[model samples]
Target chain A: MTYFHSVKLHEDKCKGCTNCIKRCPTEAIRVRGGRAVIDDARCVDCGECIRVCPNRAKSVVTDSRALLKDRKFNACLVAPSFFGQFRSEVSLGRILASIKSLGFSHVLEVSRAADVVASALSKHLLGPNVRYPALSTSCPAVVRLVQVRFPDLIDHFVPFDAPMEIAAYAARQEIKLATGCSDDEIGVFFTTPCPAKVTAVHQPVGQGHSQLTGALSMAEVYADAFKFLPKVTHEEPVYGSARGLAWAVSGGEGTAIAKDDYLAVDGLQHVIALLEEVELGRLRSVKYIEGQACIGGCVGGVLAVGNPFIARLRIARMSQRLVSASLPALDLAPSALTLRQTLLPRPFLQLDANIEVALQKLNELEALVGQLPMLDCGACGAPHCRALAEDIVRGTASSTDCVFVLRKQVSSLAGELMDLAGKLPPAMGRG
Target chain B: MVEQAVLEVAYQVVGGDFSQAGDGASRLKRVLQQIGLAPALSRRIAVAAYEAELNIVIHAYSGVLKAKVSPVKVEVWAEDQGPGIPDVELAMKEGYSTAPDHVRALGFGAGMGLPNMRRNADELEIKTVLGEGTIVYMCFANRA
Candidate 1:
């Protein structure tokens, strides 16, 4: 099967540094032949490599601005994090109006869908026979991480479409009803915060197909939207609730649920640690876990501009100013939330396909690890001694690739050559 | 009958070293994960190993935590040399504890260690002498 990945590597700009390999949460990257190669099955598109690469070799694949001109009736689903990218003084109305001038016929708020999801989740938590410590599935990167690394916790993920998908569905329906455009004529583009959302739109995890036509990066539309800032006379009708607006920042979803026993963790590494604790069964007491791959949540997405802290502050201010309201009436049938396909474990790091073979490889890996210097230096293009051992066992590398081992072997060979020279008969004594 | 392959690893746990109490279990968990064991099974083994290790750190002078891994199951053995429990039955009780007030304050001695081990492990066995030491054996099935 062909897998869709939004993260692309620019080979010419790559320095082949081990920086991204060490930072990648899924360990999906390997430096082979002076280029970083990503194992598509393991990559969750968390954008850590994009953030860590000093040469800017990594970029996300998003729909171009020309895609907007191609569609007859273009509708844009604006993410809540997009509001945080603007200046503090910029009103949400101005931003929405500016987006409208960019040739979008309809500008729908994703936070409205978030409001519906929050309400649905609150009811689900209060309902009977619910699992404790349910995990949030809103973050595509976190969901993919669970599928890849924490397969045991797959059942713990709440079975629901993300707010973006729900908003796309709503936007498409409303655009079709109002403009009388066919599905192909109306293009619903999601203004996404990260590349994972782009991947999600292309190849959704639980659903058969995504409601979104494509994803546009916030960075792509920021300048165009900013240029048309003063074109609006009046503020458009806003439908998002205060709690929904809070979803732009970390801990917002947990706060929206108002659960007493919840953990809100952000940052890819921090989320990994939290998942580890959950996997160890140490977090049995927690009722919910909200994990975001970005540091401060969606506002800290790789495509987002401005400092995350400042963005968070602005989002918080915007949420505080909004009036509390219940979710608007929308078609939220059971069919809308049900998944058509089941998510299976990726098993990206499985040692071998056969258990018996994997066992033998594990033993070999242990022996190789014992012989290694254990310096954890990234000299051999592997992260550490254990990783090098794994690479050797997988036949991608050799034990002699270690600089220390090579040096030691060279010295020993030199000593043996000297000893052999001394042992040779006195033929050289005349010289 | 074919002989099943097994891998064994051991760690030393120092007495009253609260900071390093879970080190053995943590490493064991990582090994289990790397070997591609089911997460639920790995978690069960880790929990049992951690509880046994903590018991040794809090109550015993010193101990060795050993993990034996096979395709079928994972076995954790903790042997400690220190003052042993006089009543194995009482020690197994949920609320019964001989831990000092300071230890309890530090949240080390909740008397739930053995019970938690029993709850997480598929099979648990405890043997103790009044003065010499204690030994805990826990096994978890590596179900796919």
Candidate 2:
């Protein structure tokens, strides 16, 4: 089975470098044949490759501005981090007005949907079947990471759709009631900060179909918003409470879920470290965990135009001015908000289908690892020596691919040629 | 009726070292996962092995955590050279521990180690001689 990913590489632009290969959390990318090929099963669409690519070879697949012309009724569901991009002088009303002026009929806030989800979280935590230290399902990359690398922690995910999905769903409803339009006529889209959310718009994990019909990069929308800013005279009122808007930063969701018991961890490395501990059955005391893939939360997404620190500060200041912990009510169906599909484990690490073959491969892999130089240099096109060893046993790579091993073989062959050059068979040999 | 496994691996666990508590179990988990064992089964074995390893780290002078893998089942052994249990029966209870106050402050020494190991593993055995040492052996079937 194959999964959709928003992260992709420009084959023409690739210099066959090892930058993206090393940054992939799942070791999914390999520089093969002068290009980076992504193993679809292992890619979580975290967009780390796009960030590390010195040549800007990696790109994200997002809905273009053409969607505005294509759709009849366009509703743009804005991420909380989108607000952080604007200056302090620009009021929320002007920002909302500017986004609407960019060919959007309705500009909905995902942060408002975040409030709705946050309200239900405490009660959900009290459920009988709820797992302790429940992992957040908000970040699609984190969800995919759990599926690929940490299967045991799948049950820990809080079974709820992301705020984006909920926001899109609510927007579609409101748009339908207001305009008397059919579901297909109303296109609900998200202005996403990360490629993971873009991937979610295509292939969501918790639900069968995402409410969002499309996703646009926050950076793409930022330019258009600024261009339309001056011409937009009417300032429409924006929605979302202080706590809801705070979801743009790390630990924001944790504060909403619990007063002090919840733990919010950001940055993939730190998230992975905490998850390893969680997998070992530690952190059992904590009730909730807010895990985001990007640093400083969505504001740090690679596709965003603003600096993460500045964006984070802007969001903090904006949330403070609102001063309302209480959120405006959104009418939504229970079935529409909850996760409809059960998350499944992605067993990419499994060696083989048959136990005997897998065991043999494991032994062969271990032995092959022992024979190789453990420098972990990416010259072999793999993330490290062990990954290359795994690829060797899997029949995708050869031992001689390692530069050091190749050098040794070339040296030995050169010596043998020299020996042959010096002497021959008895008939050709000199006394 | 345990026969020789096709593969065996060992990891060293230093006594009273909380930093290295889950190291052995973590490595073993990766191996079992690569071998394509069911997630639930691998998790059970990992939990049992983790408890056994943590016990050695918290109580024993020093020990070796070993794993033996066959097609059907996996075997784990923790052999530690330190003060053996005075009462095995009491140790198997849910809330029984002799760990010092310092260890307890680290959120360990909950006295659930032996019980958790027993619950998670398909079979468990303990060999201890008072004032000498203790060896814990646990087995888990690969399939649920």
Candidate 3:
């Protein structure tokens, strides 16, 4: 299946360096033909490649900042991490106002929708048939990672639409009501800090369609923010427990929904380790698992211009200042917030469609792997020695692609040539 | 291709190695995933396999865990040379265990091992000889 991936390789900029292949959690990247190739089916679009690509070859597919400068009723749904991009002293109101100056007629908070999601999640925990140690559905990259890698944990996903979806829907409704515009006339865009959100907007996993029109990377918006930030006055809209702003940081969502009994894991590698423990039936006593693909949560998104730690600190300070107010009532029903479609496992890693054939291939792969050097060196254009063996079994690679194997073949051929040098063809009779 | 329908993988489990306790079961899961077994099947068996492995780690001198997989079904057996269960029926109970305090301190002996195995595996069999050893057999039917 051709899975949609917002993260892509810029061929001209690509050095085909093995850096991305090693960092990819799913081993989705391979350096072939002196260029890194991403297997879309295997990619969870976590933007790890973007972070590791020293050549700046990896880039995200998002709307050009110019798109915001249209006459259509463009409403920008602000992520919590966006607040983390600005200095803590820059009040939230001016930030929203500055964004409005950039062409958005209205600004809405995804965090507000996150507040709605948190309450629903809290209620969900108490409900029957709730999978214990529920995995948060908030992070799109983490969700896709589970689909492709940890299929068994599919049931563990909390059956809630992500705050981005909920926020987009709310953005449209409010924009239509306020401006008396038709659905076609209004556009809702999320200022995202990661490429995964762009993919999520384009190809939502849990729902049939997303309400978001498009996504604007925070990095693209940062320049405008910088220019406008200095002139705008502080206007942090202090209303309805801005508690959800904490969602910018790791464990914030879990802490908001469940007072305790939650395990928070951050960064893709750490999240993978945590999932392995869950697979081994560990952490069953924990009520929830808060997983984020980025180290400090959304603030650590690849598209974010600010340092993740600094962004996290800004959010922490801002959240503290927003005195706890009564929460705004949840605007919709369970159907509105819950997943409409069951997530299907992406079985791209399966060796073959036929189990028997797959078994034979696996055995063959094991044997082939034993012959090759176990060095996970990326000289073979694969992440590791075993991965290359799998590729060879899959008919996409050759064993001789390994430099060590090729050298041995070349040396043997040279030896054969040396023996042949003495024995010319009978007809040629050359010394 | 040898047309061999069944494939078997076996691993040895060292006793009281808390750090490496789940290694055998983890490898088994990787094989299952590579073979393209149904996720539901692998998930249940992995859970059961981990419990059985943990039982060996907590109580046995040593053990060998083996999985045999055909197209239609998968079977796993863990043979441990440990002090056998005094009462098989009692040991199968959810809260009954012969584990020492040290094992329980590491959260290895909540007494749910056998019960969890029974719950997860479609079919389960246990053979034990007091002062001798124990052998566990679990079977899971493959589903489309």
Candidate 4:
């Protein structure tokens, strides 16, 4: 099955302008057969395609109110980025109440799980075999990109679950402990600013399955969150401070896992560049590298209702009085209570760390790469020639993925391939 | 007549021109995509093509990348008209290189080029005429 959650093309709306195709880091979209087609396996769901599509052909998957249909007890784990998207006048307490008003039985701040992730990462970072840098896996798109493009650098990624995953785990654990709700009876939903987080919930990383029932886009939940604020007051102070809250921004992970020797990078391209730096041993001294697939952190998400700059300013202003010092202390339910420090999936390294397949795929791809014209025009929707090569190897796509490459190849081979030129040699010949 | 056209794309290795270094690879990627290969094949070709392009622009002196795309497959050949490889086998090793200090300053020259090309392509052939030009041939098959 193709691995993707959000960032699908609205076939009818796509004008085949190549705007969305050019922006995709993985070149997952292409103007094929006169319209855009998303190569599911190649797409990291970073939402770059959504941001640049003028025709609004690109879209994210969403949970219908129908998701709430069968569940008995439901809770909303609000992401901190929400504070930045709405009016500061609406107290965060009111936002929680607003979420509660949306029929959620309870509202818990995801920042609480951020605390758990931070604590786990800190301990993991301070441990031995600190041989490689730790890459934050908070963003699923970023993690998937690592799996697809920077497989060798996977070792650098801390195997610990992301803040959202940990949040889902902890939130569910708390719910079950307090109310004795069966796993199926209680549903946990995440308020997401970006599509990758949603995909992560559906197709989990680090562990086999995510505890999250589904995700509610921050944009979608905004109106509901705002409407309920007038009735309730945010009584208990949230966990995490401006710094922790800042975690919603680019490089926030550096602060959360502040080890002095860390490199924080955001934006899909920028993060990929940093990973290349690590793979090249250029950043060998670096202990941790925090990579967010989106620019300006989650606020830069394509699905966000407003601009990141405005969202960041609002988030900062709202948390300004709280002070960074007030951020909650690192909390880990004693190691004894936590299972024997087993990172989910037993052998996390096998997920994408081993370059064996990537290497073999690379070799198979190499044979086909030399034929491609060196014009990373991104028209093929696999980003660059190299990405297109890897996508072909992964089986989700074919070399004809690039329109320019196919044209050039067919044109160049016209003389020798005259036998099949009866119909322009079929772009990719046969397949 | 079977045409034997050698297309050459030259690039300058600006010690730290990180932004433009990938330009060659990007162009090559577009070319491959236009040829109508699969995404996986295109990505592999692109990765190998870029790595080679970066090697020329990153470690070698101003160099030329040439390719011959045919019906059966494509072949990219990179030749560096700079100091030749001192040890082909060693250079092909995972982490070995003789790049200058300035080149190393930029974060590349990890000595993964030859090996990476070998890993990314179907058949990789490298011939270095010491103190002269080094010729590397990478062939990519077109399943079509």
Best by DockQ: 3
Model 3 per-residue lDDT tens digits across residues B12-85: 99889989988888889888998998888888889999999999999999999999988888999999999988
Name the 10 consecutive residues with the lowest summed lDDT in model 1 chain A.
A323-332
User: Candidate 4's residue-wise lDDT over A1-431, tens digit each?
Assistant: 44646766778987777687677786566666668887676677888878877888878896765687689888888887777778766666656667777887777777666666666667887798865676777788887887655554555666666666666766677778889988999888988888888788787654366778998888888876666566665543456456557677777667656556877788898987776555433455677887888788888887677788888788778777563332345455643113222232111111123333433444466677887776887666555787677667756568777777678678878866776555654466564
Regions more than 4 Å wrong, model 3: A69-71, A233-240, A323-330, A416-431, B129-132
After superposing candidate 1 on the true structure, give the runs of residues whose Cα lies further than 4 Å from its correct spot: A323-331, A338-341, A425-431, B1-3, B98-110, B142-144
Where is model 3 chain A poorest over a 10-residue stretch in terms of lDDT? Answer: A234-243
Model 2, position A242: C-alpha lDDT score? 72
DockQ of each: 0.52, 0.61, 0.70, 0.06
| Candidates sorted on TM-score, descending | 2, 3, 1, 4
Cand. 4: chain B TM-score: 0.82
Separately for all candidates shown, the number of backbone clashes (residues 3 or more apart, or on different chains) is 0, 0, 2, 74
Q: Please state what fraction of the native interface contacts candidate 2 reproduces.
A: 0.62
- For model 4, the stretches where C-alpha displacement exceeds 4 angstroms are A2-4, A233-237, A257-260, A323-331, A334-431, B1-144
Q: Per-residue lDDT of B2-90 in model 4, one digit per residue for the tens? A: 44322233444442356777666655654444444444565576678767777767656666666665446778877777566777888
- State candidate 1's TM-score: 0.93
Q: Could you tell me the TM-score of chain A in candidate 1? A: 0.94
Task: For candidate 2, write residues B1-144 as lDDT tens digits.
Answer: 743336788999999889989999999989988888888888888888888999998999999999988788899999999999999999999989998999999999999999999999889999999777999999888663
lDDT for each residue of candidate 1 in A1-99, tens digit (9 for 90 to 100): 557899999999998898998888988887778889898888999999999999999999998768877788888888999999887677777688788
Give the number of colliding residue pairs in candidate 4: 74
TM for every model, in the order presented, reads: 0.93, 0.96, 0.94, 0.68
